[model samples]
Target: MDKCAILPIADLYIRVSTEEQADKGFSQRYQEEVLRRHCEVNSIQVGSVIYEDFSAKTFNRPQWTKLFKSYKVNKGNRPQVLLFTKWDRFSRNTAEAYATIRSLEALGIQPVATEQPLDITVPENQMTLAFYLTIPEVENARRSLNIKQGLRRAKKEGRCTGLAPVGYINRTTETGVKYIAPIEPCASIMKTAFEQIASKTHNITQAYIHATDNGFNKSKNCFWRAIRNPLYCGKVPIHATPHECEQYVQGTHEPIVSEILFFNVQSIINKKREQLPKRSNIEYLFPLRGFLTCKKCGEVLTGSGSQGRNKKYYYYHCHSNCKSHLRTDKLHHLFVEQLKSFKLSENYYPICLKILKRTLTEEAALKTKTTYHLTKKIDELNNKIKKARDLLLQGDIDGSDYKKIKAGSEVQINILCEKLSALQNKQRQLSKDVNTGLSLFSKLRQLYEEGDIHTKRELTRLIFPEYLVSDGKCFHASPVTGAVKRLYNKEHSFTGLFSYNLSIKKELLTQSDSLIIEQENYETLGLSQQNNVSTSEVNEVMSLINTLAKIITIQLLK
Candidate 1:
């Protein structure tokens, strides 16, 4: 009997990375041909040919896993040999390769590299096999280093390095320089979604519905990712490695949404996240059912339906010991009437508008100064980075030290850039915000009446930050700001509402200046401490000044 005829059958495994697929000699087809020819010449029967297009940095490959499964299922009759075109096709990690080869031998299967076959019977050939395995590992490491260096250079040149996000399409110029350009429909959809969320006219769910209606077929997670992505606002994030720090660099592509809208959407998204737990799963036609509380026991009021002689009646009552009950119709009617009191008087609208304009003008001037200073700081940091790079090139600083310093400078630069972006965005949106405020003020009552359940709840929260319900009447309904408080006070005459006390106005101006100083102090204490100066605090100070100005203007109207 011929020994060749008794050789065990073999399974051929072939793999090529994306980059290798483009190389003529290392293509999957070429690898398969070589492995098949070697098995034929050895008189070994061919069982199966497996192909893979993933990396060999790990042994957890799809086809490789399947091969192991098939061998275990048909152990006694399975092919006893595994063949690959080269040691690299088996694995680039030498330690893993050695361990895997031992495991294979234990399973009665022999792993063979066609081009570099090793005879395990010879002790010296084992060392030769280890050397062959190490060559691929070295080559893989070198390729990885070169790729990282190339990516760093591209990022430094303000080029996008990865696949484009939802709204952008990747493109390459005639010279082969890659770039991203905005794609149609999806870009418009994203802009509209951001605007809707920022304006508080719609929540994320509603925005998602609108997106799907307009040809956006991605999952909710993908939609949310697009909403949160800063790339839409013309900034690119450079990822960090274990040795290097991460940074955000301004992108070369055009921004689809304004920075103001993007930041505002982020703020809204955060608020929604915080509120998600408190939101009710059960739907109630009456918006105030869950929000109302009993004044006596301070227990949340729950709603229920009662059967009358001929019809059903809906009512909200304290589920606790206190027997307080109110019909939903009566409560809703009273709430609507109360909301009407928060609306601005038509005659006071123009005076209110003028005061807001003046205040915004002053704010714009201050913000412009701050933005200029931040820009100066950013430029200084950029200069420091350039100097660090130059030092590294001149061999004055080592690579590791240069990277450390550059990373620190880049972090500070990113912080300053964020601040500058916020200031510039606020300045750009000032006029639009003023107009929106005036419009919302003028139509507060109308909006509340026509709004859906969720909108009604939001409007209620805005007007009455804290309130109590007792004997079917709303009480302690404090306004959110001084301006709103003055509007709701029935004691003030229309003329008195418009009239300004010069002395009080002067005092408020001094207070506003002090508040600005206080804000600066808070910032110096760091961002965590700065949160103490809440949105309500800043709004209160600004509102007080505007209210004083309006009160002063009413005197002029007289």
Candidate 2:
């Protein structure tokens, strides 16, 4: 019996990249039609059609892998040919395409391009295939090079090239130029966060909370990145290349903050990272730990409780073999007496209060001027938004363009509103603020003795300025703010802060010509003494302490 002869069959492979479809008019359907017509004209049997929307840079495509798997599984039913519209449609890489073609031939299948067909049986035809494959590969590389160059040029021009950062949205101009613009509430919120961090008013956690309350919902990591991004400061960071190092360029977009503010925030963040977090349960019992050092080893003293027959006694230890230790209560008494020595006499009280109020009045007036300008800016932004809305209604601008404008304007308005509101609050409390500012000068000793551990520690930092060294009997600050020593009178009754020989229970802080902790050393912002107390409130109280301390400096300097 004579067996029936099998007919030649080909599976059509159609691929259309997005760039090719838009630029070169390549379509999967068009390629399929041409391939089918070629098979029809050649009298070859039509098999399956394999479609791929992926790139042809390699043959590791899902459809290509699936087709190869089926050929191995259904060898008897598999087509004898793999057909595509052109060589580039099969693969852009010459090496991979040649390897794939050889593999197909080994599987009793011939890979063919309909538009540029060549017989594999002819040895010279391989050269033609290489030429066809090489041209497209070179074109692909050229396209990639052009794209990279275009993006680099755009970045150098201060145009945002990719997705916008938080608080911004990507938009295009009427002439089709793409850019990023700030959006609503998020932009304002981010600005507030930046200011707070820069001014050291709020720690990162507090700033993140402020952002969250103001409508930001991203993760902490995202917030951190947003704060660090120089885009907020209107600087575009160009990526590093072989020829050039990475650098920042001035951006055309409106900045959320000034460059100085942004860099200040970065510095604060870096310092926070370098400084270790302090978590001690005995803060209330031993508030002087970080402020005290050993006279012998010069190491910061640590505190611990010792059990005795009568009661548990707390002592500051040198944490070394020198065994320098002091009773915590006695040291506390010495610190309180030092603070009391700064108190003004009944005659100087009126002069000090008058000076503090005058300084505060000048500050409040400057703040009022700032508030007025902020108000003016807000009104301008509101009017801009109104004009944009009118343009939208009159068909002068499309909805997307109007939306971008409105969003940007609203962000500016929100930020100004926050600034204005804060200013108004400060102005409202001007009289109270003056009194608050004098608290450190008049009532610091009382406050330290009665206030929480946080208050005591802050007092220690402000008065000592640096480490206070003691050997159980005598102690003195390394240095104090010179303003405290400069407090003088015509009567010569009270000469200086250290001139008073203070003694409490026979432990005296010896008069020294030195000062206390530097303002930069105030790194205990995160230190919390008690449970259920808000960190923000602690920050507020600490801020008040600093303001008072500053007032003292200004008053004495005058």
- The global C-alpha lDDT for each of the candidates, from Candidate 1 onward, is 0.71, 0.71
Q: How far does residue 268 in candidate 1 sit from its true spot (Å)? A: 7.5
Provide the lowest-lDDT 10-residue window in model 2: 505-514
Q: Would you give me the overall lDDT of model 2?
A: 0.71
TM-score (C-alpha) between model 2 and the true structure: 0.52
RMSD of each: 12.1, 17.0
Candidate 1 scores a C-alpha RMSD against the true structure in Å of: 12.1
483 in model 2: Cα distance from truth in Å? 22
TM-score against native, each model: 0.56, 0.52
Best by TM-score: 1
Per-prediction backbone clash count? 8, 12
**TM-score of predicted structure 1:** 0.56
Model 2: residues with Cα > 4 Å off, grouped in runs: 1-5, 195-210, 219-221, 265-547, 550-558
Error of 1 at 355 (Å): 6.7
**Per-residue accuracy of model 2 over 19-96 as CA lDDT, tens digit each:** 667654478768877888898788888889888988999888988899899988997987888888889889999999
